[model samples]
Each structure stands twice: as C-alpha cells, then as structure tokens.
Target: MSSRRARFGVFGVVALLAWGAISVVRPIPERRAGEVISGVRTPAWQERVDSLQRGETVGGVLSRGGLTAQEATEAIGAAATLDPRRLPAGMRITLGGPEGAPPSRISFQLAIDRFLHLTRSDSGWVEHEEVLPWATDTLVVRGEIARTLYDAFDEGATELPPGARSELAWNVADIYEYRLDMSRDLQPGDTFRVLFERRRGPEGTVRIGRVLATNFASGTASIDAIRFESEDGRGRYYDTVGKSLRSAFLRAPLEFRRISSVFGMRRHPILGVWRAHRGTDYAATSGTPVRSVGDGVVVRAGRMSGYGNVVDVRHANGFVSRYGHLRAFAKGVRSGTRVAIGQTVGLVGMTGLATAPHLHFEVLVGGTQRDPRKALASTGGDPLPSADRPAFDRLRADYLALLQRVSTQIADSN
Candidate 1:
C-alpha cells in the first residue's frame, strides 16, 4: 500500500510538470473584441494631424488622407452626430491607422476644447465627443486708451498686440457697454486695466480667453466686473456685491461696421429734409444677422411705409424695442413669437428708405420714442442670485487679488 501511494504522488508531480511545460510552449490567442474596444490591446496604429484649409469639405479632406470615397462616406455618416457642417476653417483633424494601412480612426475638433472621434468597428463605425487637453494662463494688459484701442497697440514696444489689443478692448467694452457709449465715451485720458485668463491649446499656439476681471475709469465714472464660473462650468461677470454685469439688453442690436446715424433730429438722407429720426442707424453688410436686444415677445413684424421690414419687441417695465431695414424675417418669427436676448430676428438689408444696407434701432417708453443710447445707459440685468453668493464671493476674492497685483505692476512701470 505504501509503495502504491508513492507511485501515485510521483505520477501527480509529473502531470503538473507536464502541464507547466505545455503552458510555456503554446502561444496565447488573439485579444478579444471587448479588449480592443476598451483600449487594452490597440493596434500599433500611426497618426497624422492637420488643420483644415479654407473651403475644405470633410469628405474631400478624408479622401486626401487616403480614404476611399465609400470609406469617407461611411465615416462621415457615423460622425454625423457631431454636426460637422459647422466646423470652421483652421480646425484640427487627426487620422489614425496601422502603419502603411488606410486610416480606421478619424478625430477632428468641433470646438476649441471639444473633439469628434470616429473609429471603425465591426458593425461599421462609431463616434463620440472626446475632450481635448485645454489649459489656462493668467495674462495682464494695462494702459491708457490713446485714440483707439487698436491704435493704442500700434505704438512702439509698449503698444498692445494687434489681436490681443482688440480683444482686450472688445471684452472691456462688452463689460462697460451698458454704462458707457463706446463711440462717444472713451477718450485719450481714460485709463484701463484688465486681468484675463487665456485658455490655450496644448501647443500654446493661441493666446487670450474669457475676461477674468476688468476695470475701466472713464472720467469720474468707473466700472468693475469679475468673472465667476459655476460648478457646472457656466461663467458670467458680476459686480463685487454679486450683481450681474450683463445688461438686460445688449448695447447694440448687432455688430455694425459703423453707426451711420444717431437718434434725434437729422437731415433725412433720402429726402434731404430735417426730421426727427427716432432710431439709430447701423451700417453693416446686407446679410448680417440682426438680433433682438433683450428677452421679449415680438409685438409687430412685417412691413411699414419707409421703415420697410421691421420687428417690434416689448419687454418688462413698459420697455419696447424696434429693429428695422431688415431684408427678411427669420423663419417662424412673427407677432407673439417669444424671443430671447440676442436671438436673431432677421437679416440686415437696404429694404427701407435708406441708400445702403443698415439697421435702424429704437427704444420706447410708455409709447414715446427715446434715444436708444439713453435706454442702454443702465445695466438692467438681475443681481447674482442669493444662492450663488457664497461661490461668487470666493471667486471675487481671487480675482481681486490678481487684479491688484497686475495693477501694482503697471503703476510701478509707469
């Protein structure tokens, strides 16, 4: 019996040794499909990234990247969830495939920090949004407004950079647009200070982001705006006490090339007769989009004599606004249609009594037309909600410190 048990134990040890040798000798099987999808066993694919040229189409770009027409079509269709039609020129595009093989993965920027990723799958192709790496750097630009903001940057070494200078002006103007008329308010002696964070690409090719905090002193009137981003990533500018800086209405109905005429009496351009011009005239391209200045209900839409195509919106506190000289109304917009602030109502055109393409804007109180400039003198946006005070206070303290440091540097330099 002892001899028999010894023989059985030796046999078990030999079997275990044989099993270990076999495991070492045989190769493993190919990775499972789930492993590939989860990125555990990806192919040794090569990648190339490029920027889209002007007038480049997705299919055309893909075809140039070695994709067949059919492959391009399938990829585009699969990535259609990203609404690729809105992709602007200079967007980054990346293609991935095995070395010496056609690309099976395509990624393109739909926005600065957002990417649309498309990969070939057994069922066809799949697409999703992948956030690209984005970074922020705090930057400061401080100086007095001399002539114009752009000109202020045109000087010697002290001058602001072209794009950066204009960006600072636009952002600062946006903050003060409600309280100051940019056309008539800014002067040579006025000083300006801005501390903004520049959101940049991974390569740091670009500079400038949203305004973090700003201060501009024009005469005795001064304004302060601090940016606060909520937990969900929504950002807005507010005063120290937490009131929103955005006016209830946008200072301008639309971005205009120039203000052709101001409100009040003027020599009628067409008739050459002095008459009361109740609205401000903004000269812009014929196809420029015209936006409503505030949230309101469209009270009147369609034509009127001389005024031609027009839209009238009524807002809270007995305020009424008008947009005129539009080429045509936006689809589905009519009397009683609800519109939000900055909603496009129509396109700019020379539809009325004007000789050139322009928009005529007006504001009314209690049925009497008032200067649009006066109506925009006050920022009518609500204060920061009480619920947001705690979060806002913390952000405000941080920004104020940043602003103070930059301001001290500017003063010392001068």
Candidate 2:
C-alpha cells in the first residue's frame, strides 16, 4: 500500500512539472502598447489608408492624416525604397500593425499615363510594373460677375491662381478675338464661367487643359459658348448637346482699358490747338503693346508725318484699321503681312502730334473715317451653323447663370 501511494505522488509531481515546462517553452504573442485586448487571442491591427493627393508636401500628407512626424518618417523609411525627403505629394501609403507599429510594408503606385505597381520586399521596394485602371473626373465651375471678373470667380468658389486667371482671360480674349476686346469692354460687373479639362499625373499632379465652355456677360450684352474644340481630342466641352463654340472674330479688340480720347474733333495737346482728332486714343503706358483689332492684311507699315510709326490693316470687309503714335512696330509686322486680331502690331508712344504716350487708333468704313467706338456693323461673316446654335444657347445659359450667381454672392458679402 505504501509503494502504491508513493507512485501516485510521483505521477502527480511529474504531470505538474511537464505542464509548467510546456507553458514556458511555448511561443507567446507580444502585447503592444495602445493595443486593444479582447479575450485571449490578439487581433491583427488595421489602419485606415491615407490619400496621396498632389500639391501636398511629404510632411503635409502625413500630418494631415493623423500621423506624427516621427512615425511618418519611420514608416516611410521602412516601407518605401525612395527617399522620404523626396516623397512627392499625392502618394498613397498604407500603415498596418498595431496603432504605433512601424509600417510593415510600403506600396507605391505610379499614376502617370497609367498605374504601375511598386512594392517593398526584403530587398527593398521595386517596380512591380502591373497595369492599373485609367479613370477621368469632371468638375463644373460656375460664377457671376460683380465689380470685376476676378471678383466673380472668387464669389463662385472657383478662384484661380494669378497665372491661371491671366491665362484664362487671355483665352477668353483669343476666342472673342474679332468680336470683343477684353482691355476695353470688360465692364465692372462682367460675369463668366469656364468649363475645361484637368489632367492628373502619376504623382497626382493636376494639369489644366483647354477651355470647354465659356459665357461672358457685360451689361445687357452677353456671349455664350460660341466654340469648343481641342487640339488633342482627349476631351470636349460644349452646350447641352455637343457643338462648336468658336467664332471667327471677337466682338471687341480691347479689354479693361480706358479710352482717353475719341475719333472726332478734339483739342490737340502737343500742338496746343483745337483740331479734328481723326483717331481714338487708348490710354496706356508708353511701352504698352497695341494689337490688331481684326484679322487683315497689313497695307501700310512705316512712319507717317506727325503719326510717328504707323500700321494700317485692311479687312475682308471694306473696313480698315490704323494704329498711330507707336514707339515701334512688332517684329515681322510689315506691309502685305496677314495679322490676326489681338496680334501685337505696335507699341504705344508719345509719337506724332501727341503730348502724352497713347495709342492713336482709327477705323475706316468704305475708305471714310468713322467713329470706331460707335460702329457696330458686323464686317461680313456667317453666324454659327444650325448644328452649333444649340451649343451656343447652352453656353449663353451657363454664363447667365454664373452672372446671376456672382451677383448674389456679391450681394450676400455686402
């Protein structure tokens, strides 16, 4: 009986020893700080992915997405093969592990023409060269005009960069090259809207494409989308239905500039005598470049008595435009050359019988001088075709809407 009892005790001791050894030898999962405990097994840590948007600096991207600077740097170092200092904006980075675990893996996507995959491995990140989906997005920009076109854009929440605004205004002038001039008739409350293309690069950089639709309003006068075409057929912008918005001639030749004198009788400032001022005087700086009001053949290009350097352009219609008091003529702008509207013809100057530097401009109808400011006869051209008319209507509606919206915005701000 004693031997049997002793055997049982030995078995019990051996079982306890075995159990303790097993517990010590078995691998245990590490518990990390900031980790949530649920029952016995630890859950796989997951983190929300962050956007790699263009224009955001490397530091900005991480900070904006709830990452500390140290963590972002460490993660970038661990996950990406590229230098973290050179990381561009618009890069997508995924972080996994516990809330604060170093990034396990970093993936890069080349968003250029197409998506090419790049993944990090033991050897470091390398190009995977996988194909990705190509996608395009569209946005609508609308606004009204009050005080100024820039103001209208601001009111519409479509404010553009200075360079962009300058480019846009230039585009508008080009479209209306023969019909309207931005330097002259863009009134205080002119409103407009532009629909155009925007391209995203591989690094999430944004690139602006051509203008698709535009509507401009000045006083009661307005111009809807008159033409739309892209040199590259990647995109299109027209009215409700597709049609061209381009016109042959812009309505005005000048934009946002004041007329210092008219083409009529006026007192001569330099001569100190009353005389007939046969040309309109555009008030501009001495070096301000003068542009041709319409497309025409240069009939005269040289110096004239009391006119200083001059350029005369003959249009298809029986109309002629004369630029006088020019400091110098544009290069290659000689007689017999074809010049387009808005093409630099000469530079403003105090030449000829003038006291101050200005552009002495004149328009002649049928070889007779007429008031260039008052003349409204369309020099001979067909209106947009029936197919394009619907597009124009839509453009006009958009402009009107933008103008109204801008007006409302201005009123609200006031």
Candidate 1 residues lying further than 4 Å off, grouped into runs, are 1-135, 149-161, 173-188, 200-204, 256-266, 274-276, 385-391, 406-414
lDDT of 2: 0.60
lDDT agreement with native, every candidate: 0.76, 0.60
Write down the RMSD of candidate 2 (Cα, Å): 12.1
lDDT of 1 by residue, 24-55 (tens): 77754687666743435555879888777888
Taking the tens digit of each residue's C-alpha lDDT, what string does model 2 give over 269-373? 767889777756767778777877778899999989988889999987758888888999899999999998778888888777778887877888888888775
Candidate 2 wrong stretches, greater than 4 Å: 1-159, 188-208, 218-221, 230-279, 283-289, 336-344, 353-357, 373-414
TM-score for all predictions? 0.65, 0.50
Number of clashes recorded per candidate: 1, 39
